[model samples]
Target: MNFEEIKSDENNYLMHTYGRFNAALVSGKGAKAVDVNGKEYIDFTSGIGVNSLGYCDDGWVKAVTEQAGKIQHMSNLYYSPVQIETAKKLCELSGADKVLFCNSGAEANECAIKIARKYSFDKYGDGRNKILTLVNSFHGRTVTTLAATGQEVFHNFFFPFTEGFVYAQANDTDDFKAHIDESVCAVLIELIQGEGGVVPLEPEFVKTVADVCAEKDILLMVDEVQTGVSRTGQFLCCQNYGIKPNVITLAKGLAGGLPIGACLCSKELANVFTPGTHGTTFGGNPIACAAALEVLNRVSTDEFLNEVRQKGKYIIEKLSTFPNVKKTRSAGMLIGILTEKDNAKEVAAKCVERGLLVLTAKNLIRLLPPLTITYEEIDKGLEILKSVMEE
Candidate 1:
């Protein structure tokens, strides 16, 4: 169907939750996508960083398709070899004792929350369930995860959101300590605040937080949903800070472009959830697990990770020279460009109209190009972006 027809159908049938882009992507491969009108675009957004291997990666497709043909899905009652293999590889990569599969970042975070609370309750008893998150952080859209998010804007319209969440200023060790108390069971953070304008927390502050959490026995949970699986040139962003979190939640690039979320826990919290305590019917679906395995196999290598870091430096350096850019903040492929005009939304729209797809976070132009995006693709996308900025 044409773009207009597809849009009309969507407006008529679907809920208007997302502020979607004007382009209607019909097909894509690698970093290039064609809209319904047959206009091609350089996909800098990568479906919000879910396409770690770019669109239609051959190995990912083969793994997913082969597994789908064999056994698409089985109940949690049955053991899945693919799921177990995926979990084992993930544990090896992240240094986690165990993993729990889910379907989205929100679910993974929910599982993390449960693990933290359960660990605290099992040891310290009840009333120690409060979690402290940094200000301006974005967790997820679920009622519970929304509560955990430290941004006040998300707190509205939810109506009496889940309780037991407290906010601390990002990078402010004193504020973090002030927000914590005997009731706090865990501290959740994103090493690089992607949605919060690609802001990387101060390494010293993070180290201090980790130290304090350790001293107080409060579980430290790092939300790697957007930064894990080599998106930030590391298997886990916490590795860059030289700290190991007790709980780590991963999604987005975990399964190439498929739906998958994993919550990895330290050995102490590994058995916190009993068989009946938590479960999801479709969490460890064979097809998603196969795709995740393929992603881990290719993206976890030192060669690939080094390339990601180099590409990130190159991109940041290039974008920094642009006349319209005021500054740039990034970790690997996750980039935020502060436009001189301070019109991120307008700049993003112009890029989309000119055959480049980017994202906007708060007031900055965010870029989450696929990990497999080529140098040529990067140049093409940046050329379009540069041209738009020149206007």
Candidate 2:
């Protein structure tokens, strides 16, 4: 169908939840996409970091296709070898003892919250179920995860949010300490606040939080929904900080482009979730698990991770040279460019007009290019971005 027809049909049938772009992408390959009108675009956003291996990745397709032919899905009541294999790979790579699969980042985070609260209640009883999260953090859109998010903006329109959540200033050790007490069961954080404008927490502050959580026996939960699965040039972003979180939530790039979420727990909290305590219908769908297995195999490698780091560095350096760029902040392929003028959204629209797809996060232009993007694609995207910024 044509772009206008698709838009009209969507407006008639679908709820207006997203403020969508004008482009109607019909097909894509690697880091390039084509609109219905045959306009080509460099896809730097990578479907908001979901298409980790870019469009139609050969290995990812093969795994998913093979699994679909065998068994698309099996009830959790029955054992699934593919699911078990995916879990094994996740545990082996992430240093987590066990994993509980779900269908999205929000569900993964919800599971983490449940495990943390239940673990505390199981041992210390009630009153210690409160979870502290850093300010400006974005967890998920679910009522429970929405409350878990620290941003006040997301708190509105949803009344009587889930209780037992408190906010602490990010990277402020004193502020974090002031909010901590016996009532706190866990401290959830994102090492790199992706939706919060790609902000990276201070290493010292992270270490202090980890130390305090250890001293108080509070569970330290890292929300890696955006930064995990080699997006940050490591198997997990916590590895760069040299700290081990009791629980870590992952999604987005985990299954290349498929829907899958995982809540991985350390040995201490591994058995916290009993069989009947938690579950999901599509938690470990065989096809999704097969795609995730392929993603893990390709990304959890020293060579691939190093290339991601180098590509990130190259993009950062090139962005810094742009005249309109005020500053650049990033960790691997997850990047944010602050413009000298507060026109991030306008600039992003202009980029799309000029055959490049970018995203706007607050006042910064965000980029999450494919991890396997070639240098030529990066150069092309950068050229388009520079041209738009120069205008």
Candidate 3:
């Protein structure tokens, strides 16, 4: 079908949740996508950071295809080697004790919330379940996760959001401390606020929070959903902070474009969920695990990670030279181009029209190009972006 037909069907049949761009991508490989009309685009968004290895990655496709051919899915009651291997790899790489697989970033964060509450309840009995999240931080879209999100905008529409969540200003040590008390069980944070703006939390503030959480025995949960799996030039963004969180939530590029989310907890909180306490039907499906394994095999390497850091630097340097760019906030491939005119939304739309896919966070032009995107692809995308900014 043509783009118009697809758009008509989408508008008529589907809910109008997303204000989608005017394009119908049909196929892609390595930082490039082709529309139904055969117009090619340099993919800077990478499906919002889900395509870590770029479109149709050879190894990732092979692993997922082979696993689907064998067993697409199985109940959690049954043990699968692929699932075990994926968990093991995650634990080994992130230094977490155990992992609970899920289907999306929201589910993974929900798991973390449950674990934090359970751990606190198991030890302190009750009334110590309030979680503190930074303001302007985006957790997920579910009821509980939405409640956990610190943005007041999300608090609306969802009537009476799940209780036990409090907001603290990001990078404000005093504000975070003021919110913390005997009732607080956990402090969930994103080292680099992705959806909020690609803004990195201050190193000193992070250190202070870590120290306070440790001293008070409050669980420190890092939501690496958008920054994990080498997107931030490290296995986990928390690693860059030189601190190990009590709980870590991962998704997005975990399976290199497949649906998979993982919540990893330290050894102390590993056994908080005892079988019936928590579960998901498709949590540990063999196919998703297989794809995750392939992603780990390729992304968790010094060579690949170094290249990611370099690419991020190069992108930032180029964006700095752009006429409309005022500044940039970046961690590895996750980048936000702050426009001088504060017209990121308009700039993003113009880029999409000119054959370059991009994203927007708040009012900044966000870019999460695939880690494996070539220099040539980067140049092409940036050229288009530069021209759009010039206009």
Candidate 4:
């Protein structure tokens, strides 16, 4: 369909949740997308980090296509070899004892919350269900996860959100300690607050939190929804910090653009979730697992992960030199560019007009490009961003 036709249909049929860009993308390949009007864009957003291998990666496409031809989906009751394979690979890469599949980041976080609560309840028995999350952290959009999110903006419009969540100031040890108590079951944190302007937590503060969780037996749940699957130069961001969280939640780039969420836990909490405690019908779809397996195999390598780190450094260096750039923050490929001028949104719009796709988080321009994006594509996107910033 044409751009106008697509926009008209979306306006008439779809819910108006997204403040979408003017262009309507129809197809893409290897970090380049073409809109319905035949204008091409250098994709720096990567579908908000979902397209890990970029659009239509040959191996990922083949895996998903082949799996679909055989069995696209099966009930959780049935044994799925593909799911088992994906789980095993994830465990091997993450050092987690076991994993439970879900359909989105919110579900994964929900599962993590449930596991922490149950683990505490089995021993302490109720009243110890409060989960402490860092202020300025963004968990997910679901009502429960929204409650877990530390930002006050999302808390509005969602009435009577799930309770037992307390917010602590990020990078403040005293604030985090003050929020902790005998009633707190877990401390859920995103090492890098992705939606909170791509801020990385202080290393010392993170270590202190991990130590406290370990000493108190409070489950340390790391939400890796936007930071997992080698997006952070390591298999998991926690690995970069040399800390092993009790529970870790993953989504976004896990299935290489397909929808999938996984809640992985250590051996101590592995069996906390019984068969009947939680489940999803489409949680471990064969096709999604196949895609995830391909993604894991390709990205969970020293060479691939090292390349991601190098590319991130390269981009940050280039961005730092740009005249309009004030500063840049990143963890692997997840980057936030703060411009000297207060026109991040306007600059992003100008970028779109110049055939570039980018994203904004608050006043900063965010970039979550595909891990497989080439140096040439990076240079092209950076050029567009620089020109727009100059304007």
Model 1 residue 251 lDDT score: 93
Per-candidate Cα lDDT values, in order, are 0.93, 0.95, 0.94, 0.94
lDDT for model 1, on a 0 to 1 scale? 0.93
Overlapping backbone residue pairs in candidate 3 total 0
203-322, model 4: which lDDT tens digit per residue?
A: 999999999999999999999999999998998999988899999999999999999999999999977978799999999999999999999999999999999999999999999878
Order of all candidates by lDDT, from best down to worst? Answer: 2, 3, 4, 1
lDDT of 3 by residue, 56-155 (tens): 9998899999999999988999889999999999999999999999999999999999999999999999899999999999999999999999998998
Give the alpha carbon lDDT tens digit for every residue of 1-391 in model 2.
8999999998999999998888999889999999999999999998999999999899988999999999998899999999999999999999999999999999999999999999999999978899999999999999999999999999999898999899999999999999999999999999999999999999999999999999999999999999999998998999999999999999999999999999999998878888899999999999999999999999999999999999999999899889799989999999999999878999999999999999988789999998999999999999999999998
Query: Cα lDDT of model 3 overall?
Result: 0.94
User: Which pairs of residues have clashing backbones in candidate 4?
Assistant: none
What would the TM-scores of all predictions be?
A: 0.99, 0.99, 0.99, 0.99
Q: Count the backbone clashes (under 3 Å) in each candidate.
A: 0, 0, 0, 0
Candidate 3 vs candidate 4: the lDDT winner is: 3
